[model samples]
Target chain A: MTLNDTDVRAVLHRATDHLSSPDGLVEGVRRGGRRRVARRRLLAGGLAVVTAASVAGVLQFSGTGDERIDVASPLFDEPTRGDLARDPAFLREVTDAWRGATENAELWLRGEPHVVWAGNTPKGKAAYVAQRSLDNPVVVQPEGERLIGYAGFVVPTANGLRVLTFEQFHDSGNLDGNSQAVLLGPDRDTLLVLDFGHPVEYSPSMSYAPDGRIVRQRLPVTFRDGAASLPVPPQLTKVTIAVGRAPMSVDSRIHVVNENEILFPDGKERPEPRRFDYVLPGADRAWGAAVAPTAWPPGAVAALAPFLDSIGTHVVDPEAPDLTVFGATPDGRRLLVSTIQYDDDPGHAVAMLGRGESEYPVVATQPVDWAEPLPVRLRLPDEQGTLVAAPEAKLEYRTGASGTWLDAGRGAALLPAGATDVRVTPASGVARTVRL
Target chain B: MRDVRGTEFDDFVRTRSVSLLRVAYLLTGDRHAAEDLLQEVLEQVYVRWRRVRTTPEAYARRALVNRAANRWRRRARRPESALGDLDPATPDATDDVALREAVVGALRAVPPRQRAAVVLRYLEDLSVAETAAALDCSEGAVKSHTARGLAKLREALAGSGLVVTIPNGSGSSR
Candidate 1:
């Protein structure tokens, strides 16, 4: 027999009691650890040798000129104090335009250099460029330390200055093999980045259509880069992503395409249906780069309406069913993670990608600032140390064992003086003046 | 070194399982069906926990409702006559217990989404907007489901010999 009012209230009380209890979650985590480890190993095993960033001291970056930029100050703000520090003013429309462009005049003039993050062999599926723009703007800060636009890219807006960054990482994890691990989000403290504002975990879901072709989702992430970094593209809004490729080495074919009515979870924009074929070859255990459309474009699968019926809707299954993980679930299923989800086991380097303490998803991959010539400077604390900057040929770092130099797309980061353990290596081996 | 995967996952399960189970019960109705529904949902949820943990409740809730509806749709293709045995086309006697059972059984007859709307609205005491959020349907769709579910419930309960009665004309508004 169902209980009366008092009993019903008791059950409700039992359910909600944990919300206020302190150790409830802590105890649950203690229970989930074993399976997570195995999943991590499994995911790691599938990964091709991810090339390490090169050790380079002096490298030059070429970029398009900042012709449209109204204010010309190489010295930008260096924000050190984290979120507690002042936020960098958003880049002007003119500055936002140059974020994506390489081979710019100022970049070449200032000797911009970056280490290629794609891969060593370079013949992989695609390249995801994670960059850091090291510049100095002269804007002053009130409660500011300096400004570091981590998750935020350069965007030109109405007022000419705006910076859109996650004040925090909302859903944080140090998954086994995904970019969102360190792709820290903004305003994570209160905002749940689940809906629209989260970063893309650089893992794609893949499944084979009955027609013996692989269907995949293309993901493009704008990392810390030049003045030309693009904001989240139009395609990724609302849609979840899965990536897969053809098993054989044969080139990818557009077997079936369909564009159907697209609706956002919040009903913001109306996107038409689209379906088409694109090239999707398996990654050849190397670094690669390719441009992909953000969302399944409307009108893509015009002719394949019948086949489209069996194919699942273009909904991104929110859960990462196949994580390709190394651990197992509590129920004894092998932990498999895919896409951006990874095992955030503590003390592991990968786990380092997760947000601190909060266990959120954002990890800071790049920390950069420039000299006084640039307005933005990563202010030096009272600690004693000797620092260094790029193009100072004295320091040399290489990508893996290969001889590749590192350089920024815009201006290179600056080196501070004193005894700090800052090191910069490059692909090129040469003697150059140390900018002290 | 101590396999943290399953244990950590179990921790997540322990924390979120009840909330999920409550939602499952609301969707499926009854303790037994809710248990089965929750087990299936949790298994599916477990697979994606690594990623979904970013927004676990959001992902799990959507999956739960979709899976439940998909299950019903598959059953729908079977002979419509199968339900005739359970469904009382005619009115019957109404005890409070009998009334609740009749309402619940009728809920099963409705589509999963619509049934979810009724349970969330009435049994669970959620608002129109809250039901929509949980069901992940348009607010208009929630209203239609609520209306249709209430009507079907009225017919089923009324057919149970009129022995047990629902307070007020439930079909009129809320």
Candidate 2:
């Protein structure tokens, strides 16, 4: 039977109808509400004191170190520019500003702030300051000194250089993975991005027109010495910065910026409806790790017990393997599959077919060499067709060797009915055939 | 001291808690988490009682959606629990129970914002404009999120032998 809006609503209501508020709900609300009010009042008073101290230039650096001396670090090794990097007076002003900003912030500076890069852009003069933070409340365990600070641009005003924007950065320790973008400039139209290691390709944003068509636009990024600057449209609120040349590569890191400000335009510009059919839910291995257990079909655990035992306790990870049930055949036989990766061992894909009431036989098991471009193909038992697993690529499959290629969806797909052999093509690789 | 505002807030909670709890349960997919989420949203509503007393439900709903989104993001960052060797016994004898379980499980795969859009638009029977207000996005965004959410739900449900078809112009206002 086909399910529609009414059926979906009915299903949701049925799922939640039995749930009710627990006892003391109201009392709990009142108590928490009162506490929040008290905290807000206390925070307001503290902020007032901080503001006064900042204005008076009496903000004390609490962490251990000489705040006046700029410490040498690998993160701040880049040469400074913009004619102000060598000016001692200007550098001191920027350091004071950094101290004031972090005084009330969660991350406190451990060492003296040093200028990493400074330059004059179309907007104004900006400098990238790098500092060491011993205490980062965000991370659970504070390692040694971590590089954390902000990059700000100052626009010329009647009264000296006014700071237009200050974009904060915290070192995740992964240089190739660090990325951040912010809208700066007086008009809030210049997109400034600080991407370490790899140069940013472009920043793309998606919106929908009134006619329900998806509109995608990419802002080209120009990088000079690690900082990227580009002009962005005023209407766009969110952008995903793609780092590295290969956008779909596993090594590429995509950082989504301004998530809360995401907006869609009205019917001003009509763009063709982008085919979202290739997108699949929970395609990422991380998502599979989280949701796979709850998503397992009935009797699947008992069915795969033998296979699990054969793999031995040492090879089996304490964490669950990423499992996906492609679907069941017309006669109740289900295809169960999982991608298993063990530390210091080669990754492999395991497939099992569940039949009758209590029999699950292993069908196809193949090693997954991630360095290769070929998709992992597992042929089902009894000429049922192949189960294709390619998480990072778009897939297409043809029923017969010479048949037309059809969209195989995103992560996985089962062969069409009565198909003997199938050819699979990945988004980045050449086509290969999996025969039954 | 309990004042008139406190009394009114209490009354609102007493009357609307059941429906609000249901919304939380659907959004969270777990009963205990749902209770915690609803109580948290209600606490925020109580704190802003004077300002949102006239339209408390709308304010509470918007807060619930935003909080759920935040909770999902936090959960994504943490390490996930390992799957047990034994599956929990579920009574799938009845089609209704099976369908309910399928819908809830599928909802877990959807992104938090898209899930909120789907819940508000379908389960709550809200208009596009209402869903937009709750999600703090434009009407067109509401449509896009809902459509994408429905598409994902349909694909997830496909394996369960339950085909979910989106109606033509599903995200049109009301």
Judging by TM-score against the true structure, name the best candidate. Answer: 2
Please write out the lDDT profile of model 1 over residues B91-137, one tens digit for every residue.
Answer: 43334334435444656766677777765666456677777887888
lDDT of 2 by residue, A1-436 (tens): 3456666676678766655568988877876665454333323222111000001121222453212323333455556644556777777766666555444332334656667555555566555565654432221112332224433333333444543333333333333322244444544566566545444555343333332222344334566665766765552432332324334232453332322233222312223322112213333322233233444544555654433322111222223224354455444465667655433244566676664335555667777665444446676767666676655456566666677877766656666556555455556677666664
DockQ of each: 0.03, 0.23
Q: How far is candidate 1 from the true structure (C-alpha RMSD, Å)?
A: 29.0
Worst 10 residues of 2 chain B by lDDT: B80-89
Tens digits of per-residue lDDT for model 1 on A147-248? 111122122234432222111111111111121111112211111011112233221334444332335444443333211112221222222222112221
Q: Which candidate number has the best lDDT?
A: 2
Q: Please list the residue runs of candidate 1 whose C-alpha ends up more than 4 Å from where it truly belongs after superposition.
A: A1-436, B1-33, B44-59, B78-101, B161-163, B166-174
* DockQ of candidate 1 relative to the true structure: 0.03
Q: What is residue A106's positional error in candidate 2, in angstroms?
A: 29
